[model samples]
Target: MTVASPLRFPDTASAPTMTKRGWWLVVMNILLPGSAQVLAGNRKLGRVGIVATLVLWLLAILTLLTYLIWPSTVYTLFTQTFSLLVVQILLVAYAALWVVLTLDTLRLVRLVKAAPNARAWIAAFSVVVLIGLTCTAGYASVVAGSARGALGDIFSSGPSQPPVDGHYNIMLLGGDAGPDREGLRPDSMSVVSIDAETGQAVTIGLPRDLNPVPFPTDSPLHSLYPDGYGYEDRCDVDVCQLNSIYTEVSLYKPELYPQAEKQHSDPGIESMRDALEGATGLKIQYYVLIDMQGFADLIDSLGGVDVTVSEKLPIGGDENLNGVIDWIEPGKQHLNGYYAQWYARSRHGTSDYDRMARQRQLQDAILKQVNPVNVVSKFQGIADAGTQVVKTDIPQSMLGYFVDLGMKTRKLPVKQLELVPPTIDPANPDYSQIHQLVQEALAPATPTPTSSK
Candidate 1:
């Protein structure tokens, strides 16, 4: 037999080898854009991709470090309008760059050279990764845009106010502007005193029927109602209640609060804040007015709230007009927007005081439910509902600070004090006593000393 020359292999890779290499290039591109080009095809494009990838990595690392060291700085960056715009722009740019690099990577892979079976697998994987990454970046960009718009609509552009004393006292008013009612009237009122550093909170619930609503000495209303909000001759329950301050000022005495508009606030809201300051003895820095009718939408956006019901409550009915349409039974219950609104505002058999307590319960439950996962998933819904139903004088600049505080506040138990019967009758409230009680409730807890063994 003639000795044949040793079989010689081709210098170029076989179909199977090329297929494996193609997969490697695609994976490298996914992990680090432009890397595949540097390894195989276009060194220039690859260098640019590598540099961009490194810069993004550096930024991500720095952000992580900053969050660990000075978290508020990160919060401030995200909340600020200019910074948010920059972030949105960067996200869009990066998303585009990723797509470009991915396309270029496929060109470098030369998929046609690979085996038929391997070609399909490679193409499928590249498409999946491309779609997955781009979609994620796109979604994040949308979220940033939504947050920016919502913050602009919901919060004021006014200058940020410092914490009063060691805490921030924010007046929360739940207004009902039903078709039957004349104008927007606050049915629920409370002042939340939040510790500036620790985020501990004390909610002071004021009954809507509280008579003779006092005003600070500096307030214009002080001159009008020197002996409190009611008429001089008679303490009429109909005319003078804590909740009436809003509509009363808005409709009749708009001129009393000329500076209110300049400060990005309404005359009615300023008047209500002034009254709250006088009642609680806490300097109110901001006010949040929530439309009670639209309040259900807000609760629904949060995917519902969890609360323990003390007793059975009717959904919709008045003592005189209608019979009970629905009932929310007692025990730990998960309430949707419709039921949650009724849980807080239903007044058929329950007193205003009962409603006040329920409102506080809902508030606490909502705060607790606002965890990171829930917020991220339902952020758009929440933001949409918030803009429609909520109004506030809390400046946009301070939102980041409050966001951080809210996170801390959710972890701690809230201390509550409702100015109702037994504590102090709302019909005939003693101003001095109310002030004393507020101070006592807001006071820091005293730590007990431990004896060494």
Candidate 2:
């Protein structure tokens, strides 16, 4: 035994770094993945680690930014087509970073074990821990739960009343999402108007491809342009697409200008107003475009909403348009996001006018679900879950007023009018002429004042 002990030796090479500076560097790396090295004067190595962290961080930021600014077409892929998987992958990355930071902290404690100058490293780690705690507390206290709350009630202001007679008109459009499509086009265009004096709501939807809006006056657009009238603008009447009429409003009505110029068929609001007013005989006040994505998110927030099916929805498609088969069972049912979206966008059945009818029904459903009693109980939950999903002409401040208006609709009846080739029953349909009949259906009826005589 004595002879064997003579050959035994200490394996110092395998032990912790007991030197003062070595331990300090270890602590720095533990606290910040290399901050201790910089503190101990290893400038190059510390800088490299920091640069690596910055690059990874910047990459993460870029990923989030792309998700936001992407074209509506691409955004649909992320939200619907590839939604859950993309979210899972991002979450994994965040988790991995958290795990690495945790391991690094334990490694640093082990590396500087029993070192005399370990005190300095320990103090440094303590300071770093304090900073982290401070940041977490700040976010929890002020940033996370309290932003936008200071603005007062969330739905305090909204479409207080559905448009009544003598009010503005709003148009809403929804797009069907698919691998073949990227951007949003107004799928459900509704002209929601409210009377300035006696708030009333009136809504109507126009098919995306409905065009060739005819005008009473027949002249080239070039001649009508007061700003730059010339022969350049030449279209006999508004023989252009109905959607394009929004673009050509200035040409026809040189007196007015449209707001909110957007890239793809922004369809100037004024022309939309003109088209509706010309067709309906009611002066349009305003137009609102509610995208499909926003509609989906809002529906989802309600944790599924209740809607009544007025007719059997027949969903089928052909080469000319986006389509769907009948989805709902044709009675009152609770619908989730996917189902709600389909209910709103289903175009397969009989006519586009029918699809428009579904849109109004869904709107009614939403207003009913968020009534005062429901809003208080379900509003916050839905809002927290789906705030990112909605964009609307009604500002956040105005939402509460709508809540008030929605309560009124509980007693008020909803009216739907279909305007198209079949305004005349198909059996008696006259191909030769029914324009006046169709026009008469869409025109707002003159309200007669009661005479007590």
Candidate 3:
């Protein structure tokens, strides 16, 4: 008679036990999104997760290696443009992934408990393998990322430089015409200085037309759409328009655009700095850019800024271009981002000098609006949003330290000046006189007009 073999029977007493592999697989799947599927014998699902993980890791590696190498990637990820939105999406994805992994872990545990014998052993083996792989992946990532960097690495991992003590002056150059705008101007030039001991931050703005022609520099003429070509370099820099820097870098010199930004300059900041320092006799230490878009966003992010009209501001436009001639009388008023941008860029407000005054006032507005409370609260949001926009010589790692310093000893009142006709005769700018004035100005006394008549 065909009888069921005693040993082949489904005996509850002989319930199978889990092995290291099974647990390993469960842990692996739990760590990422779908790693466990591979251990569970789901070839297709395992492949997808494996591929995705590899890609994510690759990007993470690239992010690290060049952390201090360039600001383009970080800038694109952290600014007010469309990239900010993408950062937000990634953030959400990260959160969702976390939740999914937690749920998955619980499910895996349940499955492992119910399984017996070979299945349990398989699961355990998977878990162990996964753990090993995970550790290996993590070590590889850290080593690669450390070698490369993510963001903080940029600042934290740079060669040490000498201190700026003797009449140290720097410039902030804001360009308008990117690679797209051919004959754009550099209307935003702020001469900045600080005393290491006194801890002061000083700035003065200039009109784009004030110089009419900046000392020549490379042109930005193309867009290197790296988003399209993974390992491809197609961007070029044509110094046709300052605003067009992005297009030029994106198009012609995409390779050099990012590398040059960090190592040196093609649309040279050094050249710009030399010209500025040469004109004003101030030693240029650092240079940074607050692009047009970022300028507007930063202002808006602070919910606009507060400024008192120092004089009657005639807000009107040409016969056709349009003007706001409401004549804002001198008083305290809250300005929106767009309005602030216009005010900072406006030359028709009386004279070009008045626009400089507006720029300093706006800078004050920014300092006032941002406080420890605001900064801490908005840190993550800012990190996510600004990862794509702001480009500076400064790196990410050092920001927190400086931010802490700022919180401790903040700039209560920004030391500011608008280089005027009497002190700054643009027709024939007197560099030596301006330099001496700046040196003296940093010593506590208010700066007097040093313009060459």
Candidate 4:
């Protein structure tokens, strides 16, 4: 009875407890995030950490599944500014939380006195290293994942397209469609031949009005129109414009392209690539088709491209294409999306030859203006427009290689060649001469050797 009255607390201050936890707790934090916190008696923080990690993991899995099952939806999401912002915000928050949890784990370790001397220092170092590694790895993973989704969306899985003559020849098509017209038309076309080893490139522009188009032997059009794509036997009107290949083959003559039918993809681009190869004398490996109407958005995303306009250029057109909407003045001017598109497309008073030359000049301007910082800043906008405006046959597997190659190419001056007017008449193109021009354009740039003797 007397002992009970003493209100004895059994030596609570001197209670035997673990002075240190081994490096295992740091490892646990690395692997399972909040596990170390939970073990150190911070159940609330631990639970929150675990829950966040699980949610992120679930989201990653769901994103991968959606990309595989419904790629179009993924593409839409990737392109949307709001969606990209949300994703970027989530990633940043997640990274911050991960770093906070790691620091908290380190704090708990210190409070528990679980690591001593060198062990404590080692644990601290581990937390710092983990924080750095996690942040870097996390961001990289997000970028890579987004790129994968984008590549898949733009370039559908297709047959193996190997490089031809130590280079990948991609046809760049500027498609223009009008409500008044029966079908889509490629108003501008170019073949970008890139040297695989040196990343040297030549952009060879093919005049859209090129008539009496030739077709490759393996192409279905060749079998049907053995001599040329000219409508000599088929129609009274001259229905042999290179641009017509899209509408004629893609819409009217789908049954003719059995290979494209087998793949269940656009036969128009395939046929056009074949025609371009026959015209340029280069084996076209793939094609990237972009809607010309969407060119403004892309230009805006790039901030603006600078070009030296020698004279006034018109903008906009009417239902009957009767008058000009606006005019871009002369000299070196920074042109936005609207003006840049018009600069490339304006042909009311100007000849097709002038328009083609302007298009190539605009291309050169874009290549020069694009830089890494701006690219990152405008990535979301570009990505959004890219999905909607662009389509290609460049496979996902080769995206990294091409991205790297593009960077290298951008650093170097891009050689430009245009088959317009006096160079080679589009209305009556000399097939052999066009082929010869392509060969000469693609000829490797002579190396400026060292002078050390």
**Top candidate (TM-score):** 1
What overall lDDT goes with each candidate model? 0.86, 0.47, 0.51, 0.74
Per-residue lDDT of 1-44 in model 3, one digit per residue for the tens?
12222211223333343333335545566555556654444446
How many backbone clashes does every candidate have?
A: 0, 42, 81, 3
Model 1, span 196-303: residue lDDT tens: 999999999998878878889999999888888874533323477888888888888889999988787889999899999988888999999999999999989999
Q: Give TM per candidate.
A: 0.94, 0.46, 0.52, 0.70
Error of 1 at 247 (Å): 1.1
Least accurate 10 contiguous residues by lDDT in model 3: 222-231
For candidate 4, the TM-score is 0.70
> Which segments of model 1 are wrong by more than 4 Å?
1-13, 231-238, 320-323
Best candidate according to lDDT: 1
The order of the candidates by TM-score, greatest first, is 1, 4, 3, 2
RMSD of each: 4.6, 15.9, 15.0, 10.3
Task: Pick out the ten consecutive residues of candidate 2 with the lowest summed lDDT.
Answer: 3-12
Query: Which candidate would rank higher by lDDT, 1 or 4?
Result: 1
| Tens-digit per-residue lDDT, 126-223, candidate 2 | 45664564444333333213323422222223233345443545445443334464333345455554433334454544454443333323223323
